[model samples]
Target: MHLFSAVPRGVLTLLFASLLLSLADAHSYFIVTSPTQGTQLQNGAANRITWIKGLLDDIDAFDVEMSRLSVDGLILVARDVPAGSGSFNLFLQDVPSADDYYLLFLNSTSGVMFTTSSRFSIGDSSSNATATEPDSSAPTVTISGGPNPLNDFATTFPPSANGVAMPGWKAIEGSKGQLIGLFTAMMLCMAGGAFTLL
Candidate 1:
């Protein structure tokens, strides 16, 4: 009878520990990328707010909620992002005028977990001024140095003694004909240069 009672107590203790561990591991990690903190946007403009959650772990989906503070400084506008997989890209449209401020929250559908806060002021978007320009005048330019034309060229590998070599570069001589080909090409180039000089 003592053995039976001890077994029950041990089982209960294990259950309690497991519950504590589960609760501790329930929080999710998320990052807000777009409409960054302290960003300003214009009213009725498209605002792209980005967030990432649990990048290391495989999750089913997540959600985002956005709200606006009213004239009385209260949370008035609230929106929710539906369940989806991978990273989160939420494009909120028709953001209200400058008189309002937004507070955004992310929660995982798997559990009641949030990533980070999405806060911003409307009517003062960062990109709003760029969109309002009417003049198509070319942007001012101040050239300081000569043009760098070859800056975009792909990097070329040097001649390889043991690995595969690049074109116009010599490879190590083998039982095959790579070294011979290189020798021939170099001789031809030298002869051409001599003829040109003559």
Candidate 2:
């Protein structure tokens, strides 16, 4: 017996079409490429936060947040940053000097964190030994939601042998190839259905 013989032709068509659509709508992963472990970022300086995309299409925008090991909350650094930009300029003028500062990249549309940077030092501990108050204009949010986004360090690709994160497009190409194969299979199924009707 045929595997899909029991299923109606219209139902099978809809199922295959929906599967293709879902694959087509897959979101890309953003990997932070800068401020890696042991890196130092000076406070009051315009530091650049860069990232690379992985697999499928990029999201419209994402939010950037700064957090510290000693700190108890997440600080909003930037919001609605365009995904295509691939980088953001962060100014920590009012932030204190800390060696455990890290960045978080969150999807702006869904408020879900996608990636994070390793803990790095911020500001010169010798120059600014005391903790400085954050900027009054900057809004702060407490971590009271479901899971802590800080603990989630999700990535599509593993670090290279040198411990540096590198981006690859092979996964994207593989996904495209799979989609094409599925499309071809769907066409064959339709043709088979037409022949059965004759």
Candidate 3:
């Protein structure tokens, strides 16, 4: 009997399950917000930030902060606020000058945090937004409680001898291109002995 065929049906089933799991999607690690992405904000506008409920399975209630739009880590647009029930509003009392700002969401329980993909402008201030030297005295945001291995969160795991990915490989749903590539590979693998004689 061929070695592949001799493999027990139960083992094959386990292999299939593992393969399926590797294809499963991972957690959405962003602060879901109400402001249309890239929308210019009005001075003193109503900014609504929401927690992505059920993300990471058990985490909820995060502390939110807005960075004063700088690549270097020294500027906060606003102090941190609690997002209870996964939603909260930001009232710009002083009416910040129109400019791009990055939002940070830190999980209160785990200290896990995710930042906005890019800076979002406050009102129609992009053209008027001027670059200023980042203040050396500004507080730097310290990130903590990241994944066991930060690379593992964004990278797909290698296939094991049985052609199944190491336990927790999952595709990030936000990345459409990578997802398509993964799907293509998934199909090709099934056809190419990854599941031979299945």
Candidate 4:
């Protein structure tokens, strides 16, 4: 009398396979870790930008952008940053002093904004102040409900001087290594269950 008992065995197997394939196609994203809310970065100083990547596949690189809350456009910070490198060293020399600066990470291949960092302030180069650590407990500022931020701004901002690739910073093995291992273990368990049922 079970509903699934009425379905053919091959049809049930096809349905299960389809479900697994859909799960494997999940989209990837990045989470900015450093320069969180209320962090004060000094101009003309080298600051490390770090992020945690989630299930990166298909996208090979990212374009970093900076925008000010008071200004009306975006600034290109870096281009073609490798997807696997979880950290970038940014040297802010020519950037103007602004208290509402935030960073945007875009997918280079797709031109889509993947994530944005919490707002951080940049001080004047002449100031004798050092950059402060990010206040972890501060609430993040979210930017939304506007025209595509990239539409008005041209790629005029020169790339930052330091592009030091820290590939080992929080490395997550090969891009697809973890996913492949997961699929293999799942299939083995499914096959074992099938044999037991038979």
lDDT, candidate 4, 1-198, per-residue tens: 555666776777777777666656555557898789877777666666778776545455677778888878666566666656666566566567768989888864567888899999877668766764333433222222222445433222334334444376344454455667587658856864674465
What TM-score fits each model? 0.35, 0.52, 0.42, 0.54
Task: Give one digit per residue, the lDDT tens place, for model 3 in 69-169.
Answer: 44334233333332334444444434344455666656424667754534566643234532222224332222222113222111111222243333433
Residue 114, model 1, lDDT = 55
lDDT of all the models against the reference?
0.40, 0.61, 0.45, 0.64
Report model 1's TM-score to 2 decimal places.
0.35
Q: Superpose all Cα atoms of candidate 2 onto the true structure and report the RMSD in Å to 1 decimal.
A: 13.5
What lDDT would candidate 4 get against the real structure? 0.64
The count of residue-pair clashes in candidate 1 stands at 6
Q: For residues 28-101, could you state the per-residue lDDT of candidate 2 as single tens digits?
A: 45778887887776554545667788544545556677777776876655666666656655555545666888
lDDT of 1 at 24: 41
How much lDDT does candidate 3 score? 0.45
Q: Which candidate comes out best when scored by lDDT?
A: 4
lDDT of 1 by residue, 1-198 (tens): 333344454564566556545544454356665556576645433344445664333333343434455443222122233223222322234444453354344332344655545456555344445322212221111111112333221111222233344444322322224344456556655744554444
Best by TM-score: 4
**Which sections of candidate 1 miss by over 4 Å?**
1-28, 56-58, 70-94, 107-113, 124-198
The candidate, 2 or 3, that scores higher on lDDT is 2
